[model samples]
Target: MQRSYSPSVRRRRLSAQLRRYREQRKLTAAKAGAALGWPQQKISKIESGEQKRLPAAELDKLLDLYEVSGEVEREALHECARLAKERGWWSKYKSAFPGGLPDFEAEASAIRTYEAQVVPGLLQTPDYAAEVFRAYRLLPEGEIAKLVEARMARQGILNKVDPPDFVAVIDEAALLRKVGSAEVMRTQLRHLKHMASRHNVDLHVLPFAAGAHAATSGSFTLMEFPDPLDASLAYVDTPTSTLYLEEEEEVREFASMMSRTQSDALSPIRSLSLIDKIIESSIEE
Candidate 1:
């Protein structure tokens, strides 16, 4: 069960709907504000989801201006507003995800990830995750443990009754590169096999034979929501900062890359077979 709703995502949903409604009425933000006697920035912020709180009265006013008459429609938007103000389980370990990946991930109906060097975090084991973080070399032992804990907690979404459909397109190099000890790698491989078998998860491996690829630069995650009002999100993490791209043009590029990579990667069944081969021949005692 999803104990909490992702405020950021909900806000995004609300904002996108509000913007669409305003556009449908051909009302500019400034005009909408002028008619409602509101500050221009207030309307802009509400539509952008930059504001933290939206009073019920103000929402009603916007709906009225937008001619949103249906009770069901109004109620749904109101629910989105209410959920937009709520928090999720990752509040405490905020530092681990400066990118707000968990926020979007919690409510995502589907998640597609492409990795050029490492396993997707959602599919990584505790030991494997710790080893990867340790390679950062700056964090203290305690900090490393905290990150690992948070990473594991994030996996809870996968176990929920109605989990997000997850698709992972991983590079062959990532599978071959040992993260921890040989035993750790073995455990991690088995875990991957187990997870890939799940009904909602689709795992593929991009073999070296594929040669050049679309996501050659790095890895990225794209999250899709069930609501049509909420646009898909494209997340890219860099060494210096994180990017949350919501524009369709930018998101389309990432989606295209993922699609192309998936085409080149082995099928799910063959991918699993390849995993077995890796474990048998490369992973040594």
Candidate 2:
């Protein structure tokens, strides 16, 4: 079964709710912190969704102080507290390799990914993904295989009854990286070409000449959902932790960044042509 709460998403939701209650009561962070016997910075972090957990007793006290006495409100806050303490499947793999942000990414009904450095994980082949995992140099053979299988499992969502639309924007450099070997790259490029033809998949390429674009800040994925009121999410993966941006302003900024990147990227047909050219080059090698 798919999990419901991602750490980042949970943090944002809890933070937003806390801020809302505090604002309704006209409580400043300093005042609230003083009342709760906590540091103002701690209150700020919780309000901003940067903190992961709050002590259960502290949370109960904050809710009571905020006058959030409704049964529904109390239940929601308790649920957040519960999620904060729960561990995810990825945690087990964290000791071997940094876990992916698949929990939130999977929840998206539409995914827009920009890869300036490498192939996006969802579209990668098993061989190519193996090579990418090897670069980490921290995972054992069994662990690497398990991780790759987990990644591959994520692809099943694309084939579901109502699959999410996927738009991938890749840079010219990613195609030229020659990830595995000549043969492996050739096969991976062929796989991408096939995926590009899917009705739900839109693949585009940012040519080498289209330099200094908005996405130079590295790779990111903007995920949209079917729920009209549910805010879209932006995902950024780092070596240690994955960040999820759910606030309206942050989501809008990432959306604009995607628009700029897609505007300069080649169309799906042209992207296929470029992939074909890369495949031919790999063959000649």
TM-scores, all candidates, are 0.94, 0.77
Local distance difference test scores for all models: 0.91, 0.81
Check candidate 2 and list the clashing pairs.
none
- Write the residue-wise lDDT of candidate 1 on 1-285 in tens digits: 436589998888889899999999999999999999999999999988789789788999999999999999999989888888877789899999887789998889999999888898999999999999998678899999999999999998898888999999999999999898888888999999999999999999999999998889899999999977778989998888999998889999999999998999999999999999999975444
RMSD, each candidate, Å? 1.6, 3.7
Q: CA lDDT of 171 in candidate 2?
A: 94
Tell me the lDDT of model 1 at 44.
92
Measured by TM-score, how close is model 2 to the native structure? 0.77
In model 2, which regions exceed 4 Å deviation?
1-4, 36-42, 48-51, 54-58, 95-100, 135-147, 153-164, 197-200, 209-212, 224-253
Clashes of each: 0, 0
| Native-to-model Cα distance after best TM-score fit, residue 94 in candidate 2, in Å | 1.4
Root mean square deviation (Cα) for candidate 2: 3.7
